[model samples]
Target: MSSPGDLPDAEVVPKKRWRIPWIWVVPAVAVLIGIWLAVQTVLEKGPTVTISFKTGEGLEAGKTKIKFKDVEIGIVKSVVLSKDYTRVVATAELTRDTANMLVDDTRFWVVRPRVAGGSVSGIGTLLSGAYIGMDIGRGKDARRDYTGLETPPVFASDVPGRQFVLRAADLGSVDVGTPIYFRRLQVGQVTAFELDKDGSGVTLHVFINSPYDRYVNADSRFWQASGLDVTLSTDGLKVNTQSLVSMLIGGLAFETPAASLSWAQAPANTTFTLFQTRSEALRVHEHIVETYVFNFTGSVRGLAVGAPVEFRGIPIGEVAAINTRFDPVTRQISIPVEVKLYPERFTSRFESGPKKGRLTNDPKALANFLVANGLRAQLRTGSLLTGQLYVALEFFPDAKKASIDWSRTPPEMPTTPSGLASLQDSINRIMTRIDKLPIEQLTASAQQTLDNTSALMQNLNTQVVPQATNTLAAARAALEAAHSTLLPGSGLQQDTTEAIRELTRTAASFRSLADYLQEHPEALLRGKPEDKK
Candidate 1:
């Protein structure tokens, strides 16, 4: 090394510029590249978020992707059990481009095959495997922690449509994703439903797509179109349906009445009533309803709550309820039928009639007057085929005197026995009278008469028949003797022939004398005729 230092001094040149050895160059370049990569990574990294799910199913560390509209926006970096182990926590690394998309209302759910709301969805996920689906909410606030949904939304928030709320007595077969039809054409779907807090009804949220949403009006009528609507009315059997799908999966239908076509379009979030059938939804609304009850004492077998109450053949009301009450003191049960009468239905037809004032001004007074005039409610057979019974208000001039019980909560209208019931009563009375008759005594008398008749017949056969037969035989013998006596070849016949000849000779002599006398006197024309003979 000293010799090498002397040699360097001998060749003494200014210290060569300090330079990295070739072997070090490679390491330096690598370090520079590493720093550059780290800086780029730091610049491109986005906010990290944690998502809580019910389970870690179909989720894998660094493999599962979070997608928005089928485009990858983030990835699950790790999946671990939650602190309380009740759920799985997935930490995701999102791209810088999606840093602002993490919103409070943002929704995320695992995409899997599912059938709901009358539709099959996520069929594409079967081959591509399950992934986190996101729906960007229209919220302004940013959030990092999120709870994933168990089910995907029926529709994205950006879908152009109008939402409406429907109130129904029951949910029936309607559910989220149930189709909605307009004029038998599918136009919308149900988004969600909830039971009313009071538990009196159900409230459904429905969305109508853009063009179809415009068809909904303030006076639009909505009714269930699920299953087969088969009506057996006086007109005939009527079958109606929205579609085959509706019959299978259930659906709802809406229509705007012709009279309401000019009405304003319903706004988003409009509330409406859902009826059970199209007929009910489209029926004319009666503003004035009069409630009444009738105490019937007959079989209401075929009568139903919806049975019509008619005046003559015109429907004026419907049965609201049928109940039975027992009078403990009297030990009698009475069937109380509650009816809701649409008096306007009658008044509308008679608006310009002579009794318009009376009908419109004081319906109660008119009802009382009519009742006093023998207008009574009676059950009648509506359809013989179906044996359905309906209430009929008609004049019964011979009915017993009765009056309304106005003091009751729902005024009680007087009722008379139906024609069938009256007939039944008459039959029952006749049966009772027949039952009270002395049938046993009558039967004994009849048996005695039959026995006497049998004895008479036996006597005739034994004694009278034999005597008659003997008498008939004797008569036959007498007839044979007479016939023989009248035979011409017998001895008595010969004697009679001799006697006839003598008588003839005597008659000839008498005739000759008469002829001589007649010739003398020219009398006795008969004697002259004999002489000529």
Candidate 2:
């Protein structure tokens, strides 16, 4: 009964309060949704981050993110020192797509102003303050660990270079950081140096451009340069240079092509040895020692250990050792010299000569043979300029022993003569003999001889020569007159001139004949025997 009326009442009660406008509520909801969405995007994607550095040296995190390039891929979160205080590690966050760039061998370094010596480098970077320099080396192998390179590097693999080692007499004052140069051009440097354990050798380590490795080899000579310039004058040469700076701060130089060396693969560690160039002072031949401890007490002013030692008149070998010793029996200073002689080896070199097959291996036979041949040791001059002397073997014409004298034969082989010492002794003996001479008596004898010669000359000139000269002049005049008539040019002046003219005419004729004969050589063989004419 009230259905129509109830519908009307319910409608009227709902229209009583329209709580809020639909338009305002809808826009407000939309604004909230948009803000929430923006915040979520920021949390997931992050902002263009910035990493602060003590010196923001090599970082381009914002502008140059870790993407291919210009792609907003990743950013450096922060730059901070490691916890242990060793290094400055940069934390970087990669975008979803940029994560692939963090592979092995991917190194990062800070690029700043570098100054070595007075030469300054990277000065252009002063304006940019500093930057994060990257060295990208792709490793075929994958890596998850993030690591860094030991040092920021210059691109060196493509440079023209090689590796080599130098054996120096001394490292001199060379240090590890020394440069290696070629003709003053910077080519390489010294990486390290080590001393030999025996305290004998120093190993110098050096490297050159790789292409130049072929030039280093076995015969290469090395010398240390101490940056000292040397010049010569009348007082000899003077040098002004610093070896220590050369070792620590200066460099070394070498040459190739002009002086090439033999090449071989050196050890991983390169090393060279130095030797003293004193070969002339050391004997390297053959001889024999009669006794282990023998003394040669003699003057040896110019004698050297390596001086040649001779036996009789033949060069047996050389003096191996000369040393001082106090003999237990004699209790005196014994200057002992050791000699070496290789009879077999010597004979091999000279056996083909006139004395072929005569050299014997038997020591006694050789000794007897030598003594019988007037063999004696003598001093000989080697070089007057150097005052170097050598022992010589001489054969005296009036030697006592004509043949093998077995009666007084030496039980042991006689030592070969050392020329230097022998010469010194000879000079000493001559000086002694001269000193012992009676000067007054010798002077008186010389004066008497001079007086006698003068008297003989006076007698020949004054007493006998005048009359003899007059008689000889008369005889010579007659002889010359007779000879003049016989010879062509010895006659009167006119006759002499005529004769000379005739001779000249004859010579001209002969020369003409010779010329004709030369032109027709067969005419000589066919000519009539001179006088058929």
Off by over 4 Å in 2: 1-155, 158-160, 164-170, 175-187, 192-204, 217-250, 253-324, 329-424, 430-533
Clashing pairs in 1: 117-177
TM-score of each: 0.72, 0.40
Off by over 4 Å in 1: 1-40, 168-171, 195-202, 230-238, 273-276, 279-284, 327-331, 350-359, 429-533
Best by lDDT: 1
- Residue-level lDDT of model 2, residues 481-505, one tens digit each, is 8887777555476787889999999
Of candidate 2, the 10-residue stretch with the lowest lDDT total is 276-285
Residue range 1-533, candidate 1, lDDT tens digits: 36755663346568779877799988999999999999999999988999999999888888899999999999999999998999999999989988778889999999989999778888988888889998988899999999998878878999998999999999999988999999999999998899999999999999999899999999898999999988775334679899999999999999998977988899999999999998889987777788999899778988888788999898989999999989899999999999999877766776566522225576778788889899999998888888888999999998888888899989999999998999999999999999999999999999999999999999999999999999999999999998898898987888999999999999999998887786666645444555775
10 residues in a row with least lDDT, candidate 1: 351-360
Candidate 2 lands at a TM-score of 0.40
